[model samples]
Target chain A: MSTATTHTSAVVHPEYDRLALNRFGLWLFFFSESLIFLILLLTRFYLFGTSRPEELNQTLGLAITVILLLSSFTAYRAETAIAHDDRPQFLRNLLATILLGTLFLLGVVLVEWPEAPRLGIVPQEGFGIAFFSMTGMHAFHVLSGVLLLLMVYLNGRRGAYSSDSYWGVEASIKYWHFVDVVWVFFYPALYLL
Target chain B: MEAKKAAKLRLGWIVIGILAVLTAVEFWVAIAINSALLYLAVLALAKAALIVQYFMHVNQLWHKEGHE
Candidate 1:
């Protein structure tokens, strides 16, 4: 019995090891990606020194920030639902997240972009440059995040994940939250600070 | 198991609630205060921590456990 127990304990679970490794790899990727955003943030502070143009839309800024935060909540719900094998809730929350993310993108591209230039914060100079680049880069991530969530939603509809297997959902949701975390910093940097 | 997962979902709701409140206060401070840089920065970091810990489940990276 002792020998049998030792053998059982020594047996390697490749799936568990792979899961741990994947988590580590994703976090490393986040660290690297963070460097890029950090540089952009530093550049903004260097040039603008916390001075924003009077024409910037503070209301719309808060609106989009709220939307992004709400999407992160939905994304978390989706991941949790899938982990518990609740497919319907998973799909529902994923769709919600996707819609909110798309709405955030539109708020930036359609409303904020045009309003900025019309209000004299053009992208060519002054606060406008930092505003566009920061929001532009963040908007690009939101676009990609929406696309990623879309793919996950589609796959989920086809019965792709279960309680025992939900790495895809978890990873995508983590990325979604990471995007939200970035905005948590970016919002104040651009509008509030 | 389902109950546990539901509890986790509820925790998410709670965290989001805190985050919303912090954001609202951050907005108010930005509008009300003149030199609000330090206050805004602290609020931002608090929001980010709530996200990374509760929403992102950064603790999972270290533990050999199932999803919480």
Candidate 2:
């Protein structure tokens, strides 16, 4: 009598599936958040049409936009570094991103907010209502994003993530990028248009 | 693996360069052109696509779990 053997190799990595699911859930959250921003965007045009205030600080607006964009770049690098197991690069980039984010908030809150009223953009007027609401909502997101990055940075210092697993880092960076995307639309809507 | 990481790093710089140029052009258009809504909207969409695709890796959402 002869016997035959059939062998199958199945190496199950549950974390991979778990990570994918986690990412999908995060994206859904972003989609819902997007609806809020979209409604605010539509309100801007609905109330004020294409006309923007000449008093709007175009220079400061552009400066903060640049700062926010730079932060996104650093955040991207930080995520990529963690994915590649470059812990030092990841931490450094994370810090850079955090600094840029803080700068952006300062620009909006200290410079832009005070300058807006001086430039004649009050909370009561049509343009003022849209401008404050739009920028205010966005600034809140940036503040939360900065806090999340701080958490990730502290976790990184303790070696919480590696090439095989870094969901926390990924999730935080994705949120940061979403904030930048909002500003991408908001900058032009509030300043340029 | 190293090569792939290097490629990703390079891609990030290139995307940033394009974004900077687009932002400059956006400023110029806003100043030089009176009716710039259409142009600005297109530029904004393009910028968002770059961030979503390259920076955020939205394609990874569709890729198999291990692949991303």
Docking class of 1: medium
Docking class of 2: medium
Q: TM-score of each candidate?
A: 0.95, 0.94
Query: Alpha-carbon error at A76 in model 2, in Å?
Result: 0.8
> Alpha carbon lDDT of residue B21, candidate 2?
96
Cα lDDT computed for each candidate against the true fold: 0.90, 0.92
lDDT by residue (B1-68, candidate 1, tens digit) is: 97899799999999999999999999999999988989999999999999999998889888776643
- Chain A only, candidate 2, TM-score: 0.93
Task: Please write out the lDDT profile of model 2 over residues A50-92, one tens digit for every residue.
Answer: 9998878889989999999999999999988888999999999
Residues forming the 10-long window of minimal summed lDDT in candidate 2 chain A:
A1-10
lDDT of 2 at A6: 20
**Interface RMSD (one decimal) of model 1:** 1.5
